[model samples]
Target: MASREAPSPASRGVSANKPLPPTFKSIQDVLNGEGVAKGTLVSVIGVVRDLRRPIPTRNSGGSNHGRGPARRADQSSLTANIDWKCVMTLCDKSIDDENTAQNGATGIELHLFCPQNAMPEVGFRDVVLIKSAKVQDYRFGTSLLSNYRTAIYVYSASAIPMPPKSAKDALKPRPGSKASHVEDDEHEYVSWMYHSMNKDSLPEADVFEEQANRSLNVRDKFSLLKDVGDGGFYDLIVEVIKDPYDLLDKATVWVTDYTENKHFYHHSWDISNAESGRDGDPYGYTTAFENPTTKGWPGPYGKQCLQLTCYEPHASPLRSQVRAGGYIRLRNLQIKYGRNGGNLEGYLREDRAYPSRLGFDVIQKSEFTEDADSRLKDLLKRKLEYKKKLKQQKEAFAGLENTKAVGAKRKDNGESATKPNAKQRRKIQRAQRDQEVQKEKTQKAESLGLNKQVRCESEDQPVSSFDRILNGVSWRRTRENGEEEHLALPFTNIKFRANVRVVDFRPRRLEDFAAGRKMSEYDCLEDYDGGSASGSDGQSETLDSFAGPKTWEWRFALELEDASPKAKGEKPERIWALVDNIEAQQLVNLDAVDLQANQEQLSQLREQLFKLWGNLEECKRHEYDAHLESIRRTKLHMPPPDSSDNEIEENGPEQAGRRPPDKVSNKPFTCCLQQYGLEISEADPTKCDSGEGKRYQRVFKIFGTAVR
Candidate 1:
């Protein structure tokens, strides 16, 4: 039988403060002793040869696979209990590599089981020091299982510190695990193993390289998550529902293509803990709901999402590149049943042996071209339907609540006599406060007396309000389900004439209204010096004398507030419209130049803006200075600079009003506002960080209208 080697006489009777020497069993003895004792606790030290990705040992939900028929109120509820399992193969020095193992060398597998958050990270070729691992017989061979007392320490080959330096600095405990400590005597063995492994180039590295290249040629047919079956490999295009949670060797992300599968775990929000018989509910109950796994689960609820565990090379990219709400195409996703055989989950592993021909380029954007692919279109369609269904469910639940409240009310008094619960009362209070706030904002910006002060270029056109321009004009189309849907073409060549007041302007400072023109399309304007007009603006004057090129252009944005009366329940609307060089020159009636260098043009520009917005600039400057002073006082750890305009108004009738009111007069004027989509990124084949760049963000622009 395999036994732990004893400590030498010199090692014994050491200092009481020091840890005792560790005893490790050999591989041969541990396997041979398996028959003599079924479950044996033994510690071993070996070189890690291979690693397998973590898999969920338990399903996310209880045994009721929610499918076929709607679950009744009396039906047994489902609860989630998820655990993780990871496996790795360890071999003695007698077996150098897998090639030698084929010649009949021995190795034992170690199975580690813990909760997802508690799982430790072990990687390939590291020397592992496992203490008190329980040995058991499995499939005609011996394997080790981790217990509560089992601790693991890793001595990485590339990171091990050499003598006379202590290995204590180099040893690291597996992340998320409370493993046993390494004794002082064990440092020499660990260092020796590290040096010996690095003495010669291992065959495993070359083997992995060749296998990775081979993996690039293999391909699989694309299949939706709903159609995927157990033990099958298929490619999937999915939208990540939540941000990925990363561990040492793997990453976990929840994703869905908005498809339904019968075998998927059901997430419920109506079950109670007493009914489900689950105790210590650490995730706790959401009101009356017993959803332990999905307490704050973002919607498209029920069985729509699948949990995916990604291993190694793929995990790195998934952590760095992917984000919530982004779409990705996962290659060769293996669908398999969990250890309990009750639920289906996804495993994205990078197999070192017999790799796929396509290699580690498995994770990429679903739409990798300039245009959306057919599959991506289908995914979007399904996502829309899912959103509609979720909305209907919320509406139905709200209607039911209203009906209950009405039925319970005292009609004799024509009032809701039934008192609301704490949660319901808070919800009602929030809604009422929001409505009042919106009403105040809209009333403060109404255009009653200032209409005649300013005029627009397009005087004959009927004026629209900012709200009308924002909600946009849309047309109806029939969906596949025979439901009519209102679709808005966001970037259509459409223009609207609206009456608005300039409440704010961007580039913050008036002197930063112009910027250096880009030399080429590829120039990102990174060298523009952020409109700081000191050195660059003066230097540009010198360059223009010789270069004979237009060096500056106007680039700024204006925040416009609606000047019309807001309808009931309608919030105040504000939109920022970019004023490019061409439109800007027309508005101010002045050609572009270095505004800082020419004081006359700068003063004229200010006069033009004063006509457009009255004393709005003075009010803005006052507010900006006050904010800066407040920040400065905060940095100095002093009390705020007193402003009677804020304190007297906010502190109520008790406080004396000493500060003068702000002089702000913004005249309402009509303008031609055009709605368009701005290309945020240009399509470049060289960059693959995101999808083939067809990314366009909606933007509004001020055009045609000028200061007359």
Candidate 2:
């Protein structure tokens, strides 16, 4: 048996107010004693993995797995390979969750046994709880702690002495019951006690070096205590230090800047009120990190890390197969640091789990090596590029913001700028387009009869009246199903006429307007007071001489007032704002002549293209047009071929009708017709009726336009 020996806080680089208990003690007498025997309480830290007891798989309207029938199966399967050893490893994990462990048939009863003289004197058995990390497969639970192994420790008892009775039982003769001790009487009893309490012999520094390796073997950070004499390292098992810091979890790993030391001990190793030999350290051992020359080692700086242990279940009463949800693996583990008892402060070294048991190859790898400056430079460059991209995005967003704000201001200044307050107008126009898109998405989804419920989000923006005012558009409100007010064209006044003759003309009916006019008819250009036609005459006009556009004398006479006017002797500003659901007066009426004229220009222009592209956009736009014109010109420039002249010679006399309405070749006609869907007839001898040929003529008429 071993007894704990720890230096006082003053000796260690810490200020521990409470005395640390011994780390090791014997459990023999307690096993036989009548009183409550204290078992070492292990500090188990990990995420919670659900306890599963495998039941028959029952299909509940999910996916079908097995072949044969569409019928359901028993879906109550415990999907995971549980490690039964972990369950058996603990002597008894207290029933923290009564509902989960006590009555639940699925949850297990934990079994635990600890080193007697542990940090808490003797760990509290009833209060202890062991949780397995959910994802124990190749990740968190199993992989995270795979390289690690548990270390059992033994020491003589002092405060709570053993009963001294169980020791005599092993030597007792079997009462008609077969009994043969594993070893000699006293020695066998003590040895058996140790064996029963712990499975393997205590680990040593040099022995650990021989055994521990990265790939072949792993060292458990939880192994035995380390010595201190080797430059505050090799005295007794461990040294106690006081710091409020605590926990080595992912979120806390990078709490502070990384230190030079790698391998570190946990704070739980501290034994309150413990004392050892004159060396003062509870225990001591050398890590594989010893330097050949100085016997001291250096560690990585700023490389933060933590011990993340995940437990896997080999077999559980609940989970016999593997499941994705069976275990949850923790990520981003780090050592905690800071004023609040952080995990970083408790560690003596990191990297190798059990630094004391390090081997040769591991030590070689553990030694600090030259940093690849080039890689670091590359990393820095990548980080910089990422930051630059983020900044560019932010700047673009800012530009958009400014544009939006400028547009709003421009819209508000309705009568000032002749630019049509286009920015605000476009913004409002986009809202309509957005609404259309949302409607289409919804309708398509509904048509498919699938539940793709998407909410149409209307922009929460201030409405702008730019289109209604400067664009000279009108609105008529009709109550549709008495729910929404629909705005249509024709007239409805939001701003009452009070000298509303600022417009060119005002007409009540659509037919009352004349031809070739947009809003000119609705505008009132004649001045009521000044008998001037209010029309722009050929003569130059001065501001004072002109009394603005004539006023519309409405039946409802209202005093006119300017909402906002420029300072005296300054140009008046334009203003615009959006009204949500109000009837508006329309200026332009829809007409076929206007639509036809607009379409004609577009149709004619469609036949044209600029061979000299001004920019990337124009190059894309004019590519086809340019190609057609070039082909026609090339054909015209070609010399007449002798073979093709046979057609004219066979005709004998020149026949006017034989021209065949400027007939084009079948190949060219087919190409043109196929491309533009135009059909050519032989009726007219000089012209083609198919709109495409006419457009091709127009393209030829224009220098920069296409021919085909």
Candidate 3:
């Protein structure tokens, strides 16, 4: 009838009456419900696949008892809340034998709620041993949750923790910490079991090593990239189409597979529906790497064009070495799908060794090389043919312009006796000026050695810079038609400047400009195929034949107003302008990479434009009084010293009595139309003929804007 005493620790299998530590569990075992008892602690080891930025919790109203407004207090408390929590994804090959550690099925997400101070201890690809962590079912699946007693031990590459000399050594309590007793005991148990099970092998010890060792070849064709899972290292031989551009600390390069000579041409002649021609190429075929559903769609393969991202130490030097149109071989590059799920992007992987941290070899093609791959020769031949076709297209366009100019002159002579109105007369004079300007430019180009017959091989040739071809050519005009013929002024020669308020920006979506239905980022390169090019208004226009460069330019509706208005009643006039890459870069102080990658940069651009022109109400109140005052002060400067002055003039007699310098206008904004040798006649500012039946209307193309 007496109560039985509990068994002593020694009787249960201990020599000195000590408690045993919790059993170590593999991630697979934990996920399979091996240790699902409530409040049970389990140990697991894995490589950190992803670590999200720590997100600080919002401060509750309880702390604002003596503060001012809740919103104001919230704003002030933004940095005070240092308690941050983040979710991390960890993976180990043991979880799933069929899955690769990278983008593999063996990964599990863990939620770690901790103070912001603890964040820097862990990073991507770090091997970690998590101890005493509680297992819980999460929205994503089974996940580990770090409780108050959970301990995370991160292993540094240089000093990975080796198994203790003995189980007793690992279990011994440390001197400085009270928590070490439990942690040390648990660590010893896990290490003992791990070594006992695998005979000296540690879990996830080779996780980081596996990625660097496995190198995929360019011939793999991105076939190895199947899921939205783990990323891997790859080697590629690609041509640099877009050079490395910076975005914050990282640099990006756009490349294409040069060895794959698959001729997937999207031609204008193959378009099935002329009505929907402006929408997209109907008969175009998609590449094998893209979505299977879009097999016949008009778009480039995601594989054909891969974006390389270089970070930290690799970015600066890699950006300098890569150049557009150059063939380069990249090795040990990291490949991962972007967040947008469109294409597989590559990045330069930092190597542990010195001297060769990143691999990038610029391949200089040589006709004399005896062992060159046949594919390389074919690539060169294709490039030459493409360039030749581009040259022919340019010459044909120029010749067409010449014929239109002659026809315009004959028409003007026949209609001279009709007694044209002021607007009509202005149009006729503008036409005459444009004709002369075109003829002069044609002759000038020839004189400058822009050979009409062959491809312009020299970079110094005016034709080599495709700005004019991509955008539009410039022309001169007379402000007043009947004014002295000698008074005709040339348009502004520098990048076009304009004093205009941004009335509206088109295409609110970034994809509309870069990955639209009808066009890719470089669709303008294919404009030489003939037929009417798509215009900003979604209409076809033969006159404005060249569809502007894709992604390089943004269409904006601008309100062209005098920076310094002459009258209080003056109103702004609306015009359209195509802002090309260079000007957009200057205006927003951002490159295309940043603009496309970050949506916030687009908002920043709009804010910048608003700051320049001011909002609608602010712009309306802007007056020219200050500008007038500046002009007055400029004109009142004292005349040059007379001969009586002691200082000797260079040509004393002739220069002694020279007048003051000419007074310059204090205009609020520079006129881009004037800078580019172009203008809209005052008689009819709505539209003007840009030669060859092409009437450039309300659209005012601005290349740059003055800083406010």
lDDT of each: 0.61, 0.24, 0.44
What's the true lDDT of residue 123 in model 1?
52
Model 1 scores a C-alpha lDDT of: 0.61
Better of 1 and 2 by lDDT: 1
Model 1, span 422-493: residue lDDT tens: 546867996687567655644554535545544556655456666545665565655789898875654556
Which residue pairs overlap in candidate 1's backbone? 215-356, 215-357, 215-358, 215-359, 216-357, 216-358, 216-359, 217-357, 217-358, 218-357
Cα RMSD, model 1: 24.4
How much does candidate 3 score in TM-score?
0.31
List the lowest-lDDT window of 10 residues for candidate 2: 666-675
Q: Could you tally the backbone clashes for each prediction?
A: 10, 105, 10
Please rank every candidate by lDDT, starting with the best: 1, 3, 2
Q: How many backbone clashes does candidate 2 have?
A: 105
Candidate 3 stretches greater than 4 Å from native: 1-25, 29-182, 195-556, 561-585, 588-616, 619-667, 674-698
Candidate 2 per-residue lDDT over residues 1-708, each given as its tens digit: 454444433454333222111221111111222232322222222112221111111122221111111111111122132111112112211222223233222212232111112211112111111222111112111111110122222122222122223233322222121122222233323322222221122333344334322223211121121111112211111111111111222101111112123333321212232222111111221122222233111111122222222121211211222221121111112223323332222222332532221110001111111221222223223323433554555556657346577768856967465555554587689779856754544343333321111111222322221222233333323354655453332222332110010111113221222223222211221211212222312346566443533222111111111122123675432322111101011111111232233565333322221111112223322343445545765889954435335335323347422422221111100000000122344455445433334411110000111122
Kindly provide the TM-score of model 2 when superposed on the true structure, using C-alpha atoms: 0.17
| RMSD to native, candidate 2 | 31.7
